[model samples]
Target: MSNKIPYVNILQSAICIPVSDEVPIALDIKILPDKNIPAESFFGVWLLDVSGSMGGDRLENAKESLIEQIGILPDGTIFNLITFESKVNEIIKDVKITNKSRQEIIKKIQGITERGTTSLYTALEKSLEILRKYSRTNGSLAIRKIILISDGEPTDVHVRSGEENDPNYQKYFMLAKEALEYKSSIDTVGALGEHNVYLMYEIAKLSTGKYIFAENEEELKTKMIIATEQTARIAFSSPTLAVTSITGDIELEDAAQYKPTVIRMPFEKINKRESKAYLRSFEAGDTYQILVKGKIFIDKNNIQTETNVKVLELDFDFGKDGLRETKEIFITFSSDSSKFKLNQDINRKYANVFSQAEEIADCTIRGDAAATQKIQGDETKKID
Candidate 1:
């Protein structure tokens, strides 16, 4: 017998609630793949903050982290380094990873010094410019990313002292707005210094990138490694689930937008990630449509793009009803009391599990050990 491999498979479990007019359904969607091939070509930008606040040990540790990161990246990946203070300075341009270039990068990294105010927005823009310019050169097929390491907010007294309605007030917004337009992902490293964590978190979240809040130099190095490794291991880029049709009061839970459902699948975190949308119907038989669309860049020589949509038009013994089973979902509605109870029990059990899972996630995000332990105990009891 010959073996076969599948790109994706859906194991769907669902629960439904009956109503006077429509049926409400909840589904648990788990997208699974037997294996994934990582992208080979990668272009990265190191936007280092050398502001005066990053003086002494902070600057030294940051420089060391940069050097270590450069030393560890796999060969054939291309990267650039830039330092931002009162102005933006590009220390290195797009150079393919090699022993010689790596040494040059490390030597330049050690030469960096902290002195001036932070020109955060300028640095962000400059990094994007470099990524865009080099991304198309030499017919390169690569994943692009910007690793922004900063110890403080964007501050320049010159911009602050300018005329009324200074651009400084809107620099963050401007950077975020522009960054969204570019396809390159941004991973932010907020080092321990006088800075706005919330602002950094928002930038990372909106860019669909990873946000690392480093409390010390060691953590900073670890987070950098994590970011680089995660970038290298990206299994999917620009993954999207598009909903083509909907009926009744069916609402999509995680849809960024509807009416040709555009699932918000960010480019940064795409490995085994889950996307969900919900539906509620007043009638027994109602249907919806979804199209899974994405492109797989195999290599510079061959880039494959595919858009697969769920076939929505179905014909039955009766006739075409403009309804069909979604690839990952099938709904069955009945008035049987016993069946209803079974579905209800399943729904309640999973609902409790989901609630506990969410609680654990919240506690973990907030770094609350006490709350996490309590919630974890509750989860264990439920599981038992």
Candidate 2:
């Protein structure tokens, strides 16, 4: 029997109709993972900012947090460390961090102190090179990632006066774009310092990775751990949802890809008034429902295996609001047009509820405030 679980799970709301003129209705859908397997070998590359701005407690706290992260990693994980001043410095190449070299790794981490200007582009370039080499030689058995922690803006150490043309704003994005070719990612951690927040965000976004911002040293520690843990859980392959069937002329609006071939579910689509009227025309005193169809695709053969290492075990959430294995979107149609008014308050409220839910999820991911109270309330209810 295969040990692998379903790669992606479907989660969606089932609409209940008291009455509708039409037998089926349109519904929104979301794709979520049921469980994720940890990679057999994780290739971690740390891009640290050792500039003048990161001097004193800021730098010290960063080093300490990084040390804690190192202490918790499982054996046989290959990693590299790169620190940036005015230039990029590689403390280690792609080395499998074992007990013998762990001490040496610690020493190198401690030796890094604040010095020159921050050259983020150079560091990222070096990081990507390491990932490419590893992928070619070691094969596709590792979850390769670059962890970037920076406190200041990108500076050109050689550009004394005017903006230096070569490795400017475009350089950062170019490096991110290059990493994608090798299936490598760059997860950026933004700390307290003067820098372009959007730059850090774009670096993560373009690489199909994560971006976390810390307001203080304490938060930085928490965020770093979160990033590392997530990096380790990189899925073997991205799953695509194949729409099996549709009952209505519902639009699939827009979709945003979260990972390779992984589309976040319940994408927004504008429903035309005509589509609404067709369903609303159903006679009163009758109830109807629509079924949307899809299945998650997982390529198990591409999943890599390691010698002597047991796969990391993780659990799946099957709660109603938790991760679901499959989705059944029930669009209820009622004969009482007044009770289930298509254009009136009933349908409007239904759309508003789902719209707000999607917005809340977006804000939470961005760490911004948008109906924060409602989000907290929903979360609290889930916990209880």
Candidate 2 colliding pairs, count: 14
Candidate 1 deviant stretches above 4 angstroms: 1-23, 32-39, 135-139, 156-181, 246-250, 255-326, 341-384
lDDT tens per residue, model 2, 256-343: 3221211123322223211111000011111212222222222224222221111111122221133323333333333344544232
RMSD (Cα, Å) for all candidates, in order, is 13.3, 13.9
Model 1 scores worst on lDDT over the 10 consecutive residues at 279-288
TM-score of 2: 0.60
Best by TM-score: 1
Model 1, position 356: C-alpha lDDT score = 58
Q: Write the residue-wise lDDT of candidate 1 on 310-356 in tens digits.
A: 21111111111222233434333334545542245434534555465
Cα lDDT computed for each candidate against the true fold: 0.51, 0.52
Query: What C-alpha lDDT, on a 0 to 100 scale, does residue 333 get in candidate 1?
Result: 38
